[model samples]
Target chain A: MLKNLLMALFVVMQGAAFAEIAVIVHPSQGAAISQDDISRVFMGRSGDIAGETFIPVNLADSHPAKAHFDQAVLGRSSSQIKAYWSRLVFTGKGTPPKEVGSDSEVLTLVAKNPNIIGYVPLSMVDDSVRVVATF
Target chain B: MQCTKFVWVPALFVASTVSAVDFQYGGFLTVGAGTIIDKKESAYDYEGFNCPCFISDFNTAGLYERGDIGWKQDTRLGLQGTVRFQPGLSLTAQGVARGSDSSVNLEWLYLSYDLTNEITLQVGRKRIPLYYYSDFQDVGLAYIWARPTQALYGWEASNYNGASVRYATFSGHWEIQASAFAGNETVRKSGFARIYDEVNQDIRWRNILGADLEVTRDWFTARVVYLQSDNSITDKPDSADFSRPADKQRVFGLALNADFNDWLILSEFNTNTRKSRDEELSIPAPAMSVGVGRRIGAWTPFINYARFWEKSKDADYENERFIDLSATLRYDITSSSAFKFQINRFSDRSEFQFVGATTLLSANYNLVF
Candidate 1:
């Protein structure tokens, strides 16, 4: 029984380590978006992209994809991200992105809003949203 | 002040009943304890407090006395709520319950409107933007130190009734934020005054005008600020030594900070000048703090040095000088909380031994929810 449990844990860790994050936007968003733009938007440094205000959405912190996205795109750990936002939030300087529960919820929200941007595991990408970048 | 405790309750209830309003509430907590581990043989007398004492928090008059472990010096709870009436307009209110005074004080009540995507206008009560961390100093979780170095953060008044305009935008590879503010503040029974005198003293900063600019690129950040105001003091018991007429005061400050993943550096310098109308008394006080830290996984160890010195042209005026050296270790308990332990060595170099010399050991658990 212990061997089986160990095998299952190793498989889960391998899956998490190899998973890729895909940045997504509404299909209606036609303008070219760069990685820098996505980084700025997610960091609350800027909201403008291609002369339009872009709203960034986030997956809940509990989601594995959230950790993957944070490490791959923002180059920050979950603790660092929380600390960064705490400075902005307590000072009333900025607010973090709105959060949704899962990849499906993120896709649904992005599909309904032309300006909303989000991220999910590459395997969860669907026809409702366009994948802008993958890492 | 009894009504202050229930102020947010009504606002929360109103927001809940209004279908169009979006309400969000959060809070921060710090449970801190400290003691004077070592001290000079002679007591340093200053009004109500004496030797073997360390002022852990100068703004709130938080002091750790002789031998007993004190939790009231740094413990506090703060709540903040934002009621968004619309996409561009919102109201924010914050209140803090302090362990030192055992009182709930309303700290911020401001109305903010987005004039443009890059510009914001705010009106009402807000923290005096005197330093980089002044706005969020009460939220201990936001900073790596157990407390801001007292050599610089100690002040007469912390908040003001003010109006300010803030602008934020990206310039090439730099992220820039700038603001200009003007207001006035009056503090009753000022904590800063209590350090020197036993009487209840009132202090006022009138026509307070200030501006600041901050720019960041990658791992580096720089900030500069300038402020000027008319300051005056009045003693409740009519003490001749404490009361001063309106004097012109100006302050200039700068900060340079860098965070390169594993390595971090934080530094700040400030100079303040107060001149009397007759030009007989001119006091210039300069203070600086430098801190460096290295992050290894969830543990970060830091060391810091801070100093405050006052130089007066008049030889008769006694100069006040002090230095603080601290070492701290912080452990991230989770994303929303942290545990920190710090040791401080405070040395009094003043002509009169203003606050005495002592070594302190302190710890805190900080969290935001």
Candidate 2:
């Protein structure tokens, strides 16, 4: 019985370590997006894709999906990204992405606006918004 | 403090009466203290200040004398309000209280219009971007330095009544932003009191026009600017004047920056020339600064070197030169706040030294809300 309990704990740990994140866009967004494209969009470096402007939505600061997305795709820590956006905001150079509280809120908003893009845990992906890439 | 109260009273009154959705507010603060550790007196004493003073600008900010840890030199607070009554149009006003100035000042009050997704126009008072850090100098959380290299970033008049057109665009991996501005400014009480013999002077810049271009690609960025103005100086109590001509002043500046995630590099060079037929008045002033930093987790440590040379063509005028070396450490307390400590060494290289060689120790806590 003890051996069976240890086996269950190892499986849970492995699942947590390898959790998947999905980059989502409006259902009408049909163009392919690479990881670089997603990074640029979230960093305020690019505003358009396929000759149309798009708004990048973000999860709240403490979200687990945000931590995973920032490290795995954006190649930056949360603190570094926050500081980067702070410089731009105070200089009137750019505004940061609008933040929602949870995965479902992001999905709901992206579903309504063709110009909005967002990210969530892969398990939360549904038919309302299209998943462009997954990591 | 009275000035601050006077300005905030009306601002707060307006905010309370207005619809909350139309108005948004933000602010920033920096509390700093510093002291000089020099043992030698200055060779040439400035009007009221004793040496070995840490002269950030000859007479403006960072004026540290011996034996006193003073907070009044760099501490400051700023409040900003934006009113958005319509889409693509907004009005923004910013008020700042400086410890050195001992009064509240209107730093930016402008109406901005978004012509399109990528173009903007602004009119009213705004910061004159003479250096890379000039526009956001008051927002300490935006920069890594405890203070920007003063030798290259100093200016008597930092704002103007102006109109500007800005365009931003991206092509593949390259991003470009360019702007053209025209404006004029008048400073009634000169900030450069030491150079003006302790008398109140009126400095004016007329027919001011300038253009700035910035380009960025990945980790590298570069900026270049040019400005021209008709400069004049007159005594305030009495109308004694300095000789002036149209297009009497011209300035050129360049900056290059690189940020490779963990590594950062910044450099800027500028030259200002007074155009006069008389060789005595046709002097050129040049300044340069270079800095590098490394980020390790939440802390960044940096070093900077800066120099300024005031070379006069006339035989009777003495050239003044100074160099500064600084080491700074910035630790982020949170995403919007930071604590910084810096040590600076200033060396006077001119024959007649106004501020002798000195060392300064300074620290600051900065926050944005």
Candidate 3:
């Protein structure tokens, strides 16, 4: 029984380490997004895409997908991003992206708002939302 | 006096009426103590303080007087509240209390309306964009320095009743922001007494028209600003006192900053002139500062050099000039909190002994909550 429990724990840890994150948008949006575009959107540097208004969504810091997405796509650590936003927030220059708690919640938000772009675990993707990019 | 008591009534009313919207309350605090290590007397005593003293602002005057460690100079608390009525509209109010002022003061009360994704219009009182850090100078957690170099940040009035229109746009790997503002202010008792023989006088800046532009491409940023105003002064117009004739004021400023994740560089230069027929009454002040820092994990160590000079050649005017060399270390206790220790070496180079050479040591714990 103990051996079985150890094997189960190892498998869970391995799965978490190899989890994939996907950047998603509403199905109606068809614009292509590059890594630089993703970075700009998440960093509050971009206000729109092709003259269409859009907003970025973020996962809570405690979520494992958040760390993976920030490192793989945004090219910054969680702390670095926080510090960057601190400068903007205090200066009244910009506000960080709105945050949600779970992948399912992110899927719901993205599916409902064509103007929002978000990230979730690749396994959470469905027909309701379109995958813009994945990492 | 009665008018001052009603300043927050409108804000309170609006906040109360918006029960469904999100209301955010945030604040920042800095408790700092420093001492001037000077042993000799100098002409800085004109402001009733010893040489080597640092003045952060006109009201928060007299810091680190010779041989004294006190928290009354740079310590301050600021509170800000925001009520968002919807996606593109909001009201923000900010108040600050400094150890120097002993009373709470409203620093910002503005309504912001987003006309488009890239344009915003703000109406109400705001900080004058005289320098790069003028907008968030009170938030210590936002910058690495123990304080923005006082030599350059010092000004007679920092706030004005104004309206500003701002435009921001981002291109591939580049971002630009531009602003145009107009405003006026009347300080009943001028807080800047050091330049006027330590006598409190009423001061006014009328028809203030200014523009600021900033551009950033990746790690580098540059800014330029220009402003012009008409100035007037009186000892106390309503109390039967002397008055100084109005004059013309013009200012120009520039700043460049670079951040390479772990390495940082900050620089700014500014020149301002008040012109009048009376040479003694005319003032020309120019200042500059440069800083470099590197981050090692959660710790950042930095050094800065700043200089300010009075360029007016009037024989009747008291000449003032000083240079400051500072070394600072910052430790981030958390994402929103930091501890800083700094040492400053100040030197006087004026024809008149308005300031004397001295050393200062200071420390502060700053946090935003």
Candidate 4:
């Protein structure tokens, strides 16, 4: 039968080349994060983690889990995070992190914002968010 | 003039169509070209430009003369816009459009705010933060150099009218940032005094004050800066004879960077001075730049070196040096575009041989959208 549809399309392309990714938040948010506070809140340089005021979100630069969350949590590449946010968005100094489009739209904007934060693909996490780190 | 500085870009799009702001908008472009594939013939003559020229932008005196190529010495086109209005205030504006003076100026028009989540508070007319890529030097897809190093990035007043504050945090894994500023400027027809008087000159700096600091870890970074000012000039056919008054100036800077995920490094150093309220003239002026690169995927190639010298101990002041060397490659071409190719040389060890020794051969394409 066409070799079982080419072994079911090579196991769904090897499970999307070894999926993984996670990092969500908002199951009534409980602060605790590190990997350098999610790489300084996805490189807009901190917007809190233990001082509360979170709100990072992104995954739409042609999402492939945004190139595996920009090479596993912003170690860069996606053209160096688009040249580091084009030098902080042409120098008004910073503003980058607010993009959505998939993984159920970042699990419905991190299950309806409790100070949002996002990332997905650990088999599209469920239970209304709260994974808080994985790469 | 320049449509009254863009009449606030159609009044910020009619105040973001009557309230509930947001706006956004972006842009950037380069499309460059160059020429002067080598030269040496010197006999001094800057005010009439020609004879191996190559100023490639000294605060927009962007020359390159020496026949052919030359798409306005590094084309341009910016745009930017912000708006926001809530969640911590905002309102930016930018406008560019150059091809060397086919006009359309009004760079940045600040207003940021966000006084917490680690400080920030800007005011108006920015750029003059003086190096470390002077706050996104026209965003050539955020640099890999197709330009930068016009011997220490020349300036005579690249905007200022400011009030700044910025602060960013993350201690213990480093990544700090700081700034403080106060400004004034006047520039009127001073493309750095038309490379030395042709006519319309006029420059000032006045009360300006400054500060800077930067830090980073994980592939190192460092920076420092300081400044002070009160300079002056005005000629407009007043036929120079020598007398520049309000001089007090001071500056100091430093930078160091590294990347290491495919090797890269960049450096800078500066010194300025200027005294002379007739204390038998002081002058000073030192500069430096360094670069290196190596990323081979979407290409990257780089190399650079720069200098500027000019120390004077008054023996009748005459120094003014120069040096530059470049070699770029870049490529990316997506993720917001890029495509470079350079090859510069410049030398001109100065003793009034102003824009002499040259070499150049550029190309660019940069973009942002």
Which predicted model would earn the best lDDT? 1
RMSD of 3: 6.4
- Cα lDDT of model 2 overall? 0.79
TM-score of chain B of each: 0.92, 0.90, 0.89, 0.33
* Candidate 2, residue B226: lDDT: 91
Per-model C-alpha lDDT, please? 0.85, 0.79, 0.79, 0.80
Give native contacts recovered, as a fraction, per prediction: 0.56, 0.36, 0.22, 0.61
Q: Candidate 1 residues B168-239, lDDT tens each?
A: 988899999999999999887777777777776778898999999999999999999999998888856755
Instruction: Supply the TM-score for candidate 1.
Output: 0.92
Candidate 3: residue B269 lDDT (0-100): 93
Error of 1 at B137 (Å): 0.9
Q: Give candidate 3 misplaced runs (Cα > 4 Å).
A: A1-21, A27-30, A50-52, A61-72, A75-80, A102-104, A120-131, B1-22, B39-44, B194-197, B236-242, B279-282
The alpha-carbon deviation from the true structure for residue A64 of candidate 4, after best TM-score superposition, in angstroms, is: 9.3
Per-residue accuracy of model 2 over A1-135 as CA lDDT, tens digit each: 999999999998777766898988888889988888888889988877777677788887668788678878888767677766766655556667766668888888778778878998899988989999998
Best by DockQ: 1
Per-residue lDDT for B1-369 in model 2, tens only? 001222222332242346323455677899999988776766656666777888654335448888778898778998887776665678888898888886799989999889997899999998887788888888888888888877877666778898998999988788899998899988766676445357767677877899999999878999999988887777555665644553378899999999887999989999988766544467688989999999898899999999989887777777778899999999988766899999999887865646778899999999887
In angstroms, the error of model 2 at B109 is: 1.1
Error of 3 at B76 (Å): 2.0
